[model samples]
Target: MEPMLPEESRFETGLVEVVGGYAELPSGWTVDTPDARDRFDVSRLTRLLRDHERHGRGWPGSGVDDVLVEVSDTGERMRANVVVRDGDEEIRAWGSVHDRAGGRMLFVHIVDRDLPDDVAKVCSDVLFHWAEGQAVAVGSARGLEVQQIDTGAFEDDARQHDWLEGAGFDRVRSWWQMKRPVTPDEATLVPSTDKWESEGVRVRLVGRGADGMPDHDDLRDVHDVLEQAFRDHFNSREETFDEFVHRLREDPGHRWDHWWLAELLDVPDAPQPVGALVATEVSSATGPNGSYVSYIGVLGDARGRGVAKSLLSTVIADAAGRGRDRVTLEVDADSPTGADGLYVGMGWETSYVTESWHRDVPVTGTPRQQG
Candidate 1:
C-alpha cells in the first residue's frame, strides 16, 4: 500500500516489459510501444470495458470514471497496447501488469470486454507471456522458477471467466463489491457516540494534512489498528508504517478531514486510540461525487461492543454530510468475521461479483536462498 520510489516503480514495469517481450505473442499486440498515448485511447479502452460489463455481466455503467495510462515515447516504462479489430469496431485494451512487491506472483489487470472471442483469446495469450517474463525476473530475485499470472473477472461473465480458465487460470476465490446510497434521512442510523463518550472514547476527525502532508502519528495509528483488525482476516499482511503513510498520501483524491481516529479509554487515567476509518473522495466530472471507505478497523479488544458499527455509522453520516451520493467497499466472500453480513445489514447491496483467477509462476530453477 505504499508508493515505491521512482526507480522501484520503473523496476516493476521494466521487468514486465523486458522479460515478457521474449515470448511470441499473438498478432496485433505491442509491448512497451508508442501507443497508449492520450485520453482518447483510455476512453476507448474504458468504453469497451463498460460495454462488456454491462452486456456480459449485467452491470451497467463504468466502475472506472477514467483510465490514465503511461503516455510517453521515451520507452522508459512498460506500456502495452493491443488493438483488436472486429469489422469496424476497434476493441482497444492496455494492460499495466505488476508483480506483487516482496512477492513472486505477477498481477495482470485488463479492463476490456465484448471483443471477438478470437481477439479476446489473443489478449489472454499476450498477458500470460508478459506475466511469465515478470515471473522469471522475480524468480531471479530469489532463485525461483516460474511466476504466477494472477487476474480477475466478474463471476457472471461466463465468457471471460471461461476464457481465463482455458488460458490455464483457475478461480481461486471470489468477492462482493458492495455499494450503498447515502440518503439524508439515514442520519438516524448514526448511533449516538454517547456510549463511547461515557466509556471515555474520543471520536474525532484526524488532524490536518498540513496542505496534504498529514501527521504521521495519526496515520501510523490507523495502520496499527487496521493491521490488528485484519490480522485474523483472510490473507492479511502487515504493511510497514512508512508504506501506510505514502500509500494513502499518494492518492490525489486523499483528504485529511476524511480520516477519522477513535480513541478508547479502557482506564479512567489512560485513553487508548484503538480504531480508525480512512476515506477518500471519489469524483465524477459528469456524475454525482461519492465517498469510498478505503479502510476501517478497530482493535480486537474493541470488537462486538458497537465499535465497528459506530465507525460505519460515522463514515456513512460523514459521506452524507460531504454531499456524497453513495459509499462503496469490498468484502472478502470467505471472511471469517461476518463482514459481508454486517455490510448487508447496513444496507450495502451487491453491485457485482468478481472472481480471482490465480496461476502460480512456475519457477523452473532452484529457490534462491536469502543471504
Candidate 2:
C-alpha cells in the first residue's frame, strides 16, 4: 500500500463523510476502494463497525462529521475521525473512511501491526486521541454530542484486536456473509396449497397494468401492511405512506415485478391486506444475479397464518417467471422472533452473518436515550 498524500488528510465530526481525497493514518494501515457499495456491501461494513465498537475496539467518532480518506502502504487515502464524551464511563468512539465512485466503494483497512507493548500503546493512544478530538470538534460545530464511533473490520486480524484493546476497545460480535446458487429446480418449487387453507385467509398474485404500475389501492394497502408489520422491529422508525413510497422509488434497483402482497380473508366484507414483500432485480457488472428481497412484512394479526411463507413462495414464483436465477434477502440474526429459522425453513441458507454493536446515549431534549 502506498502512503497517503498530505492533501487528503482533512477531518470533520457529525455527519457521515461522503467524500475525501486520500491520506494515510499511521503506519501499517491501509484504506482503499471496495468493489461496490450495494446493499450487501454496506451491510457488511455496518456489521464490522458495530462489532468492533461493542468489544471496545471502537470509540465514537463525530457521528456524520468524520472525514473519509483513502489509505495505503506506499501512500494511503481514507476517511478518519475521533470522538469524545465529557462524563461517560466507557470510552466510546468509531472512525471509518470510505470512497464510493461509479457504484464501487473503497474502505480504509486498519490492523495493529505487531509492535512491542509500549509502542502499540502509544499508537493506540494516538489513534484514540485523534478520534476523541474529532468528536469534540464535531460536537462544537454541530451542537450535538459525540456519543458513538463506527468503523469496519478486516477478517481475523490478531494485531488489530490487540491494538483495539490497547486503545480501550473490545470485541463485540461476528457477522457472516452467505450466498446460495439459484437452481432451476429450486426456482420451480413454489409452495403449493390447493388444499391448504387458513381459517380466514386467501392469497393471490397482484398484477400490474401494462404501464408498469400497480393499482393505487393495492399499493396503499401494501404500504399499510408493511408499516404495521415492522412497528416493533429493530432499528425501525415508523414510516409514513409518502416516506415508504419515496424510499422504494429512490432505490437504484427498484422494479415492479418483485413486489408482492397478501390479503386476509378473515374480514368478510372487505378483505384487508395482511402481508407484503418487495424485491428487486439487482443488476451488477460484477456478476449476474437475480432478485433480492428489499422488504417483507406480515401484520401482527396475521402471524402464524403461514402468511410469511406464502409471501415468500410468491416471490420465488415471480423470480422464476422472470427467469431470475436466485432470490436473496437479509434478516436480523438476533431477532427474538427467530425469523432466521423461517427463512432457513424456506430453503434460504446463511451465507454470512452481520453483527451490530450499539451504545445508547441520551439526547438533550428527549427523555429517552438514542442508539
Candidate 3:
C-alpha cells in the first residue's frame, strides 16, 4: 500500500517511536502509517481478513469510508494505525488502536493468515506488544491506573483465540449476531400517525429541528436513556454526551431518520423518555440494503411496559417503508436481562457468533511526553 505523501496523522509520534517493539521486527521488514489514499488497499485487506475468518462467507466486508474513519484523525477520540511491510513492500500485518472511551481502549490486530506459522507468530507478538504500550499511553493520559484492551474474534477462528490467549487476553464474552427479515407489507407495521403505541408506551422517530439537526433535548434524551439502561450491563462505561454523538456520527451508515425514541404515557407526571433505538443502513453489494440496530435501550424503570418491543417494531416498520430487506442486531448471549430471548421471540435468528477478548494493562511509570 502506498503511504500518502505529506501525511497527516493524529498519532503521537514521540510516544510511538519510544514504544518497545520496533526493534523486534526482522531486518527486511518495516513499519509504516497509512493515510487517505491507502483506504482502498486497507479495505481490501480487511475484506480478505474477514473472509478468511469466516471460512469464505462471501461477505462484502468494510468499504472505503469505514477504513477512512479509522485511518483519519478528525474524530473526537485519538486512534493510530501501523502496517508491517515485507522487503517487497507488501503489507503483511496491520494494527490499529483507538482510545474509545475513558479506561477502555480498542485494538484491531490483523496479520496476513497466509503466512507461515513462524512468520505469523512473530507479527502477532509484535503487534500485541505495541498495543500494550499504546494502551498504557492512553490510560496514563486519562489519569487512569489501568486500561482495558478490548478486541474480538470470530467464534470459530481458533488462530485468533490462540493469539489473544498468548497475549494475556481472556475470552470474556460471546455475542449473537442476529438478523430479522422485513416484508413489504410490514411497512404498515407502524401506524399512519408515524408512531407505535401499546400499553401506555409510545415510540416515534426523533424529531429534527429547523437546522436539520436532531432536536437538542430529544438527542440528550436518547443519550440519557441509553446510558442509564446500560449502566449495569457488561463492560458499561460512562461516555459524555459529546463523546456519544461524535462516535455515532463517525459511522458511515448513520442516518438521522433511523433514530427513534420511546416515551411512557398515562403516567402521573409528564411523558418521559423510556427507550431509544438508533439504527443504520446496511448496504449489500447485491440485493437490497438492510437496517441495523446499533443501539436499542429501555430504561430500568420502564422494563415490562413493552417499551423495548415498541421501539424495535418502529425500526422494522421504518425499514420496510424504505424497501429494505432486513434488520440486524447483536445481543449478549449471557445478558442478565435475557435480551437474547427477547430478540428470538421477536423473529431474530442468530446468523453468526463473535467473542470478546480483553486484557487489562496497568499504567505504570511516567506518561508519554507530548512533542
Candidate 4:
C-alpha cells in the first residue's frame, strides 16, 4: 500500500480541493487533517458516536486502536480523514474515506450527539460532501468513470438513515450482527491433530513458510476460494488479490495464525482448497476477549459437503483453545444461502442489526482527472 500523494501536499491541499461540491464550513468551525496527536480527542468522539448508536443495541463499540488506524497517516495508506472542530475547539465531527478497491469507496461519517439538530445536520452535510469529493478523486485515480460510495448505519439509527438518504444514498441491504458463546469444553470440538478431517474434507491453519510469512500458494488458494464463492452474493465486486490482502491487513485485530483453509482430499488429483476462513482477535477492557470471523467462504461445489461447517467449527474450537469467551460474525439477513439460519443453528444469536447504503458518484473530466 502507498500513500495517495506526497506527505507534504496531502493534508495542506486536502480532499475537498480535489473535486467539486465542497461544503462551506460554518463561522468559527474548522476542518483539518488528523494526526497521531489527535487520537485522544478523535477516539473520544468515536466513543461518543458509538454510544449514540448503542442506545438500543448491544453491539461492542470500537476500541481506541480502531480509531487510531483511521486518523494516523502512517496507519492506513489508502485512507484519508478529517475532523471538524467547533468554535470551542472541540472535535464535533469526523469523516474518513477508504479507497476500498477499484470503483468502490467506504465512508465513515460521525457527528457529536449533543449538537443541536440543525448544527448536526449541517455537519452531516459537510461530511457527505467531503465524501463525494473523495470518491471522485478515488475514482479518477483508478481510471474509473464512476465510483460507488458505500456506507453503513445501524438499522435503528433514524438520524443516520436520514443523513444517508439525504446524501443520495439508498438503503441496499440488512445484516445480522451475530455472536456465539465459546465454552472451554468446546476446545475438543476439533480433532487434536493440527489438521481435522471428516468425510473427505480436511481443515487446518494456513501454513507458514521458513521466512515466517504465510505460504503464498496457501494464501492464493484462500483468496481464490473466497472470490469465487462470493461472486453471486449481494453487491459482490471483483477485488484484486493485492487489494484484498492489503485491506484485510489494515484491520487492527489482524493476525496471521487466524487464517484457515479447507481442502478436499477425496479427489483423484492433488488436494485443493474448497473453503477458507479468516478471523481476528477482539480485545475487551471489561471482560474476556473474543474472536471475530472476518471472512468465511466455501466453494459452491463444496457447500453441501459440510465445508462451511467444518471451517466454522475449526474457528470455534480455536477460539476456545485460546480462552476467548465468544466468537462474533455478521451475515446477510437475505443471503441466498440462508447463512443467517446456519449461524443460528450453530448457537449464534443476533445482537444487533445494520443496513448498507450506497450512492454511485460519476467521475467526469475534473481538473485533476484532466491533468
Candidate 1: Cα lDDT at 158: 71
Q: Per-residue lDDT tens digits of candidate 4, residues 1-371? A: 23233232111135447433434556788776666675568667667557666653655467777877777655445788777778877788888887666677888888887889988988788788788877777777666798899998888888888888888999999999899999999999999425888889999888898877888778889899999999999988888787688677778899889999999998837897999999999998888889999999998888789988888998999899998999999999999998887899999999888899999999765434321
Models 1 onward score TM values of 0.78, 0.53, 0.91, 0.91
Residue-pair clash count for candidate 4: 0
Question: At residue 321, what lDDT does model 3 achieve?
Answer: 88
Give the best candidate by lDDT: 4
The residue pairs in collision within model 1 are: 142-368, 145-363, 145-364, 146-361, 146-362, 146-363, 147-361, 148-360, 148-361, 209-213
Better candidate number, 2 or 4, judged by lDDT: 4
Go through the candidates in order and give each one's C-alpha lDDT.
0.62, 0.49, 0.79, 0.80
Please give the TM-score that candidate 4 achieves against the real structure. 0.91
Better lDDT candidate (1, 3): 3
Q: Candidate 2's residue-wise lDDT over 174-248, tens digit each? A: 543333346555545555321123556665545667776766677778888877788787545444464356446
TM-score-best of 1 and 4: 4
Give per-residue CA lDDT, model 3, range 6-89, as digits (tens). 122223544355354466567788777655566556665566456555552335356667777777767424677777778877
Q: Write the per-residue lDDT of candidate 1 for residues 1-371, one digit (tens) a residue.
A: 33333233323345344544423334544444224455555566666656766765675554433333233332222222233333334444445453343343435345355556666666666655555555655555545444555567877777767767776788888888899999876655555422235345666676555465566677767778888888887545455565456556545467777887788767758667788888888876676788888888888787666666677788788778667789988788987777788899999998888878877766654443320
Clashing pairs in 3: none
Which sections of candidate 2 miss by over 4 Å? Answer: 1-180, 185-211, 214-217, 284-287, 361-371
Question: How many Å off is the CA of 263 in candidate 2?
Answer: 1.2
Q: What lDDT does model 2 reach? A: 0.49
Q: How many residue pairs clash in each candidate?
A: 10, 72, 0, 0
